[model samples]
Target chain A: MRKSMRITMILLMFLLFLLFLLFLSGCGDKIDLEEAAVPLAAGIDLDENNKLRFYVSNPVFGDKSNDVQQYNIPVTSLRESRSLQDAYTSGALEGRNYQVYVVGRKLLQHEDWFKILDVIFRDARNTVLDRMVAFDGPVEEMFAVKPKEQPPLPAILRGMVDSKSKRGTTVLTTLQDMHRQIYEEGLTPVLSEVDYDSKQKSFRLLGTALLTHKGKYAASLGYQESVLLNLLKKKATKGVNLSFAIPGEPNADVFELDRASFGIRKIKTKIVSSYSDNRFRFRVQMKVSAALTEQLFKYDIQKHADILEAQLTQQMQDQLEKLIRKFQRNRIDPVGFGIYARAYQYQHFKPLEEEWGEVFSHAEVDFDVHVKIISMGTIR
Target chain B: MNQLEKHSLSFLQFVFIIAGIQISIAVLSTPREVSLIAGTDGWITIIIGWLITSIPSFVVFKIMQRSSEGTILDLLRKKLGRWIAILFTLIMAVYLGAMAYIGLLRTLLIIRVWLLQNTSPFVVLLLLFIPTYIVAREGPKLLGRYAEVIFYFLFWLPLVYLLPMKQGRWLNLIPIAKEGWGPILSAVPGVLFAYTGFSVAFFLYPHLTNKQYAGVGILLANTITMATNLLIAIVCFMYFSPNEMVEINQPVITVLKTIQFKFVERIEVIFISLYIGIYSLVWIPCLYYMAYCLNWVRNGSGERKYLIGLLILIGIGTYIFIPTFNQSDWLEHHLTNFGIVVEYILPIAIWICLVINERMRQEGQPG
Candidate 1:
């Protein structure tokens, strides 16, 4: 009886193990992605008739080679759909299943753009966030301008974003970040806009696209302006090029200012209020170590570093003032002045939200740039 | 008609089970709320709460050391009379059983929403309870030994979950003590709940090889739990704004899902599977405690059959009652609040009464 009981127990254990293995195998079969194609990048646009146009990419094996190739398929709808499901069904009829549908540039003008985003997020199949992008034109145009000899559109975009050599403005914003920005107070959503040339079959980043809270197309910041915005937000690299002309020089000399290496001794922002006219004045004091890129003057630049410091200080001050005025004109609060007001002086920001455009326009901003050339790139 | 064999658990096993109980389904949802109350200083609150809860744990451990051969139920009966002791034990047993059932249910709901959407909750619960009931039926020693082996896997999961910290904003932790002491004080009770399972050591004292080391073991376990909670809370705080955290249904799991791995697409699926080990760790002790309480109440004879029958009834009732996520949430909140009172306040009260009784016994004696 004891021997039989042991044998029965052994058989029972074996049966349980087999059942466990079968359960695992069943789970494995349910999770098959073989039929489903994973999309790398998605683009959306509105056609001439204001119909929803969806662009999707899927990689396929190249002929006579082990290398993979990407193909862009465009699908267009006859009428503007209120829901993504409608748009998706229309696209599906065109023989393309969009795993991710980007909100086209024209949709930025529509009031229900956030509703589109909600539809995308609600779907489980469209799980990838990094591949989603918002375009300035028809989404199909972006797909038409692939790199001449690149692995794929996704690889190209990923390389551009991850490139270490590209100083400043290299960080890529995912769809998740954009979603957060939309909900966050005092922050505007920024997306990379890809403009394509059909004749040349080439695509280039048309700088960052900015959106207003009501899904209005505010404006696109040019490449240089976007770089400046990134720097102000501290999202850009520390080692960015700063160009300024000498007092009598014919040519403008460019200096690579390594902000990381530059010893910033102090940064003080004083908010001074004048009893007269009820105006707030922002005075910024910045102290930094100077580094020279080029020596235009024959005189010992180090000896008369004080003169160089004065010139550089004035240039930096003027540049910063121009950028600040530009930001105010554009009604962009990338410097997070609004965030500061809300977090610190909540009462002040309560009314400022309604009158932000006018308030920001008249706000006094003073810059005090003090530069001391602590070192000259470890060379005399 | 067999009595439960006296079985002892190793220190490591005790730590694993206690840690599992401490890190519950609430940790997935409550970190953000706690952070909102305490701001960047929320980690400080976890530490403070751990210290406060440790005091009771220390007192219970001391009492258990004195009565080395008896469980907390025994000490309660000896010190505070049988009726009150039985009443308190009943309350604790119910609370623990509810908590275990609710935890299993909540986890099933998460799995359904995130992973196995097609699978029924009953099937999921059955799958969970089979392993849990088998191990729990083996008595506390085997449960503890199994916990010791599984604890290694649990410890390694957090390291993988926290890899996305590189992108976390350190600035989000700024403006420390911004809300001041008022909110911090209010959030202490919730933080105290995170350290609730340290009291489990009291019940498991008889099963400990060295009852004296139980205090040290509990303190060490509490410290580790406190640190883990603090880290997760801080990370959640840094990742999401106060408004966003509150809006999220399951903040911890959602945060884990946000972390995209190059090789592994969704880490939350892994988290859900590994969490079963934690659930079993918590449920076994709770079931054992329930059995222990029932045995004591029935005068310790023919209790094994009764214990198994009661477990099945409780499990089935809980499964039926908590049919949806909303209902489970309501049950969990009320039970956890009740748990704080029974687990912390009542234990301290029993300890005080026991101390007084010992003093009276000594004073009443002639020198």
Candidate 2:
């Protein structure tokens, strides 16, 4: 009896292992890559009839050529848009591989426009690392261009925004970051802006679009100004290069031009704010290790170093003060000064948390800048 | 009848067993529940919860130390009457059996949602039970070894949470005590659920190799659990905004969604799938104790096969009956309250009874 029981146990174990293997190989619905339309990019815009329009782009490989298949549909829900796209395709449309989400300016005008994309963040399988870009015009115009000599539009747009942000010319905003910024009370959302430049006949990067706390489009900052904003926000540490002009003497042989161009390196920004008497006092301090990357006029570096440093500091102070005034004028705090105030001054800032933007608009700010020329571009 | 010396566990193994059971399913949503109550101060409530749960944990150890029988059930039979002992055994069996079943169901549900969305619940539970039965049938010594192995393998899981710190905002943690102590204090009960598995100490103490230092082992286990919960809470607090933190259903796993790699994306999917190992840790001990309680009543020798078959039947029944997620959530909510009564209140009540019985027996004797 014992021998027979041992034999029976071994057979049972073998049969269970076989069942395990069969189940491990999945018996129900499966994700088939070939039958799935791996979307490259998705765009949201408002139709001419004031309805929500969603567009998805997927790449198709052919026998003799490669092309991107585009699907445009007006829908009330984002998940339902996939089914609409499926009517024109041979495969199931999926959002798992989308590299970018393009939002038109018209769509962002609504206060709660961000609520529509809740499915992306809520779905367990959906990926949210895609780049989020805001187009100045209708998103369809940007999608209509099929660069004859380049890769897909999504790859091009992602590459363009990524490289520009790395060079401190613009900001890179992902869907995850945008989600946090939209909800964070101390910070506001800033999306990388893109537009179709009709003059150049191609899509172009247009710095950053600043949004209010409710995610409404407030204003747009230019490329140069975006770099400054990034520096102030500490997003750009080493790659910032600022171009400024120094007034030149017309009579001097070497200083014939009206102004001379120079760049600032190693830019460091500090914001010191204190709340008292229902108002915030901000002391903006900046220190830069500068260099003369280009000079249209000749001046001795060692002889005029002190004068240039002083003049550069003055110019930076003027420009920084102007930028602060513009932020105050628009009543936007893109630099996240409210974040610092709440962290450093908890008791004083807690009561004013909800009205922080309005309080920032009425606050008094002063600029104190220090610039030191460390090198003259590999020259004396 | 088993020998007492043959089933003893070392001190570290005791600690690992308690810590493993405490951490399994609670860590998945502990941060979110705490944040919903206390906001950014949720970590503080976790510390408070750990200290409060330690009282019952010590009471369990003290009661076990006073017993000379092989197990808690045997002691109950020796001190109390046979009827009372049988009553307590049934209560414990039902409690532990429910715990094991709910834990397995939740694990399978998460796997279905996060990792294997296409797989059937029955198939998933079948594969999950294989490892659990294999490890648990060998008893506490091998269970200890399994817990230790899973711990060492998954110790790096917390380190993965630190990757989200790149997007963290230190400002979100500020304005400390902004919501005041009321919210933080109220959140302690929610945090206590994370520390609920400590009641396993009642069953585990009689098997300890060094009973003298069981106190230190219990405290060490609680400390490990508290530190894990605190780490995840603080990371989630800093990574997500206050409003956003409350919105997240599972802050620990959702925070992992931000982690990306060039070679492999969606690391959380892989993490949740591998988390099946740790999930089995909780069910193994619970199922073993449940069967052990039944054997106490029946005086049986082959509890292993019966326990494994019972667990499979329960898993299949729950899968068929509780076919939807909302029903599972509703059942889990009720079970969590039941878990509090068994894990929190039962130990202290038993300790009180043991004290009263000892005093009454001393009075009855000629002193």
Worst 10 residues of 2 chain A by lDDT: A254-263
Off by over 4 Å in 2: A1-31, A63-66, A248-270, A290-292, A295-297, A344-356, B323-332, B363-366
Tell me how each candidate scores on DockQ against the true complex. Answer: 0.22, 0.51
Looking at candidate 1 chain B, the ten consecutive residues that score lowest on lDDT are B1-10
How close to the true structure is residue A20 of candidate 1, measured as C-alpha lDDT? Answer: 75
RMSD of 2: 3.1
Candidate 1 lDDT by residue in tens digits, B190-245 = 77777777777767777776656788888888887887787787777666655456
Chain B of candidate 1 achieves a TM-score of: 0.92
- lDDT by residue for model 2 (A307-338), tens: 87787787777777888788888778888888
- Deviation in Å, model 2, residue A203 alpha carbon: 2.5
Docking class of 2: medium
